[model samples]
Target: MEAFVQSKREDTAKEPSLFLLPEWMEADKRLTAGFTGRGGGVSAEPWTGLNIGLHVGDDEEAVILNRKRVTEALGWPFEAWTCTEQVHGSRVAQVTLAERGKGRERMDDTIAGCDALMTDVPGVLLTSFYADCVPLYFYAPEAGAVALAHAGWRGTVGGIAARTAEAMASAYGVRPDQILAAIGPSIGDCCYEVDGLVVTEVDRVMDELKLPEGERESCMQRKKNGKASLNLKELNRQIMIKAGILPSRIELTTWCTGCRTDLFYSYRVEGGKTGRMASWIGLQER
Candidate 1:
């Protein structure tokens, strides 16, 4: 079953379309976790709708409005919307009260130079932008902790998944086995073709993984044209498994952003200039 469930709704300007992860949210009413879709925002073309990225070329006012709409839909206070300046690295920042709402309005004050954010601080909604790259979410309910990570191929090679788990352990004493993880919507192997540099780096990571031959082939397959089809989601899941997260506790989404352009913004298919979706997870104060 898909982990991210798209709630059906009209694409009106008032409410943005959302794909929610109820496995975490419903289990604990205080938690709000979901990914935004490509509709129902006020951004102009290229970004078009619901573009929650301030880094993108979308107008400042439009991007801010779109983010406000998402916060409104989640019934979360806009002040709790914390974000990161994603550099496609493995760095994870431990968000605290000081970092709360750091990047909601503009880019100048966002948490700098981080692709992953974890917080035990309630009311700090952690967010990261995406437009095909994987969004990995982490939660340790017993520890009152939640994390949001943005992993592109670069971050994947840098082992961001394991790094995130380690950060949670160090900062919150949350064991990897106790962590609940979800790999959100991203480019699937069916549409993610790669060559040269990507293929070489992926090879290095796979060798480090030391996966069995059959299991290895499932993650990446070379094509007749010398390009390889990479299953980033599967590979990231394996990385999480290697980090000690139980396979049974992980939920992987089947939505392929590259193929679902109507419902998502594909940075690859929608041309290089396009909008980005937001992956958010946080716990409200009791």
Candidate 2:
């Protein structure tokens, strides 16, 4: 079954039209986690609707309003919303109460120099934006912790998934076995083609993981023309498994952002000028 369930609504602008983690993963109601879609917002043109990215050339006011709309739909406080300036690096920042709402309204206010954010502190709704790059989620409910990572090819090769798990274990004593990780919607192997430098980095990651030939072939397939189609979502899943998280504990989404442009924003297909969706995971305060 798909981990991310799309909530149906009549008008996206009037209600929350986003993908949600099913109840099985959030049975306690203590955790609120999911990814946003490209509907139910006020952005125009290439950004279309619900572009929740401040750095994507969308109107700043529209991006802020769209973000507020998302929080409102999630029944989370707008003031609790937090974000980062994703540089596609593997740095993970530990968010605290003081950092809550840091970048809710302006890009300048965003937590700088990080591609990932985690928190054991409740009420800090950790979020990161995405167009085609992968969005990774980590939840250690036992320690009241959760994390969100933006893994482009660079971050993936850098082992951001393992880094995030290590951060949780160090800061909150949350073991990797106890972590529930999820790879959210992004461009699937069916649509993402790469070559040259991109291929070289991926090759290195495969070697580091010591993945078997079969597994490596599935993660990235070489085309007849020498280019390769990369499966970033699967690659991240393997990273989590290698980090000691049980394979059964990780949730992988099959929703390909590139194939579902009507419901998602695809940087490659959308001609580079596109909006961004958001991945959020946080523990609401009791």
Candidate 3:
């Protein structure tokens, strides 16, 4: 139930410490997950410092070194890290030991083709990159299973988080109640504005939009103007609740990438010119 926050230091000479969720607080022996803020790593300038997204135009060697730093910070072997190409779709990939190093071989690996990844194998780090889009992490200690998902507005409306949870349950026998979720840093409600298309898609997936007593009309009315402010974090939280996870088990980082330009990357802030931050999870080998 405790939370830890690590701020980035201006100097790189200090040992890079990736944020971590305390094991005692989490009460889960088999799972570990955290979001990597913009600090750490070797990329410079636009992709300066710990930029993990390979396709973001950073030098290949810098990106490789950044990944190595991240893996080392997490106490994971460099070769055990697994990430996919995220297409903002609802597809989820199942990872096994045999599949290790499949996605990291080259930037063009199939990992980018899948938006979500799940695995029960220890030492296999499952990761997804993001800027403003929400990154969802799931862990089922009893089943020794974990998953990472990339949820943009489209994927959110498509119920990607819920689908990933269901997949973990079906594939690994993880009970929804036993699953612990961490909704990582992303664009918060303060900055996320959408159009009618997004609202309609959200309504289609969510049973009813429950607004504050006097805010119902205003909430729906904004959609008609072709632009409406949406709370993506809250929206995804609702999706998790509907999937049967308890509200208490979910932890949300209030840091908004769009708001904190210096600490994290944001597509909204940089306008397609920004690098990406990463959220990663894996089980340590016994």
Candidate 4:
């Protein structure tokens, strides 16, 4: 019951691979929401194929080309490929038509120090890069609003999920119950282990959520040595539910980027010199 499914590619394409949300597609033809994979790109060596992040040590030209490939495949104008400079904070920027395509090529052009981008404007694609961290998506079709958030450990504890819901409600009058959310591919619990302060922060968030004993243990498992394996996707899902999104309305993906590095770029597996995949959502203008 994974929500993010691999997209069938044309025989000729070599870069810009994608995984799409089929249910979202069926629910609204004008909506496009999904994540990118590691194949079909112009980067060389460590980045291999399709590294869409500009600040991740990949060649700027190569990264731009890879991003263009995704825009082309989605039939969205490259001029609308917008992004932000993610700093793993819970800051959400309200994207306007004027902000469209701000960071498509130059990193400095991106919305500064923002990890989440939300917009009600049609045709403005919202995107954020990720390797192992979680990608949280939000859509309020009633208000024609969509958001994409980058939630690393810092952002997770900072409550980016709840901040996104609040931003949607304040900016677009979107009710949390009316919002549909999707947690995209990231490092799964099996591949993600942390200790010390990381554990402390995660536990703090769990406490805020008041997770039941069984659920709390499922969210974090301790090793004999004191490190803990964390389920980031599940944590974010619970955070969204606490923010008012129904459990049934959130689509969680089981595709762990760390476990399936063949299909994704995992910073953990690649020793921190890896590429980044993108999560994108937009409402195409009719």
Candidate 5:
């Protein structure tokens, strides 16, 4: 589908109800974004509570209600959320005016084969599910746009975060410097060990982009066993920087999913049999 430029005003807010909301951006009533930790949902064991992922073997009804609770907590109408079927690719979907209610009644239709979703439409929440994959959020207040991306090794190697940022810039006329990014909790460098193939791919991308020599090595440091420990959060942060976003405009969470089992579900720690956490961003209605 062809992407069109849109005009709107953007602001951001975050909640502090035990959720990992950003303190610096919580005062604005026009933007809402947060990650639901492993608490406050209705799924039973394995899935536990506050599991917002419907495809992760959680009870469908419970997932629905949990989604509702999250929306209600944000004071947004429950029907305004928009999510997608995330394929670990670099594709970014630009949400338009017509897709406002897709989150409630046509979720399946909204499940495009993409890793990122962006919108300038106010009150339309954009969401993505992640276990070990990094959840990245983008906002350009001056352009009135926001985007959410799920970046696993595949997506990272494919440059999904950069693609999402580029989409926002192209579609909303947002300067890279004006974009604010958040690197949410994920499998940190302390726990994410990868094979040589991943190391090679990451190196190849870094070389192709001519990323800073020190930054690249810092993200792909090796462990004693020769297996490289990948810092996805740092890699993605570099992606944003390469895309022209200023360092001061980015915020990162120090929580590691693999380490904080009580707060987040980690696919690596749980052998792929774990619930997924939801990371979302949206513009509130004026």
Candidate 6:
């Protein structure tokens, strides 16, 4: 069974064209977590899809309109929209009520160089833009806390997943076992081939993690061509497990951005200049 349920829109220009994690969101009525799809927006040309990222060259007004549409579709106020300047680093910033709407419209307003956003503030939606990088979601339901991490290869190797969980634990007194984790859509092993430097970093991270031989092999399938097919979502899942999130509690997405560019914006397949989807998690006010 796929974890991230696709909510398809008949019209490409419709709102809320996205994937929802029903396992987490439906189970907890107050929680909302999902990834945006490359449909139902007003961007043109290379970004003809629902480009939710403001940092990309997409028109600011168009991007904001798309974002506003998504919020309305979720029954959330656009003022609750919040985000960070994802630097593909391991830095996790704690968002408060005062920063609830930071970076909703412009780059200058975003929390600088932060790859992860975690918050216990109800109604504050924590969001991060992505183009094939793994999106890690954390929900300490027992503590009423949620987080979103942008795990590009650098953020992954830097251990952003563990850092976000640890931050949640420290800030909200959440036990690792009590956290519900989800891995969102990204480039899967089939289309994410890596060589040289990437392979070295992955090996180093696995060594530090002390993952079993089978697990290590599954994370990186080496080919005779001296390259490896990297399963980033799996690598991040293993990391979440090491961080104390239970295997059964974690929901992994089968949607591959690289293999399914029609549904997702793939930076690898799109020659780097492309739109970005948003992964968001927030606690609603009662």
TM-score of each: 0.98, 0.97, 0.89, 0.98, 0.89, 0.97
Say what the RMSD of model 4 is. 0.9
Q: Name the candidate, 3 or 6, with the larger TM-score value.
A: 6
Off by over 4 Å in 2: none
Where does model 4 exceed 4 Å of error?
12-15
Regions of candidate 1 where Cα sits further than 4 Å from its true position: 10-13
Give the alpha carbon lDDT tens digit for every residue of 1-286 in model 5: 1011111213111221234344424645677777776666677888877777777777778788777877877677878878888888999988887776665533476657888999998878888888889999888878788999999999998999889888988899998898888888789989999987898898888886687778878788877887998999888888888888899888877878899887778989988877878887888778
Kindly give the stretch of ten consecutive residues in candidate 6 with the minimal lDDT sum: 8-17
Return the TM-score for candidate 4, rounded to 2 decimals.
Answer: 0.98
* Total clashes in model 4, counting residue pairs 3 or more apart in sequence or in different chains: 5
lDDT of 3 at 206: 52
Residue 184, model 4: lDDT of 96
Each candidate: what lDDT?
0.93, 0.91, 0.77, 0.92, 0.78, 0.92
Pairs of residues clashing in candidate 3: 84-111, 84-112, 85-111, 85-112
Score candidate 1 by TM-score against the native.
Answer: 0.98
Candidate 2, run of 10 with poorest lDDT: 22-31
Q: In candidate 5, what residue range of length 10 has the lowest lDDT sum? A: 1-10
Better of 4 and 5 by TM-score: 4
User: How many clashes in each structure?
Assistant: 0, 0, 4, 5, 4, 0
Can you write out model 2's per-residue Cα lDDT over 58-158, one digit (the tens) per residue? 89988888888889888888999999999989999999888999888988999999999999887889999999999999988788889999999999989
lDDT of 1 by residue, 148-266 (tens): 99999999989999999999999999999999999999999998999999999989988998988987898899999999999999999999999999999999999999999999999
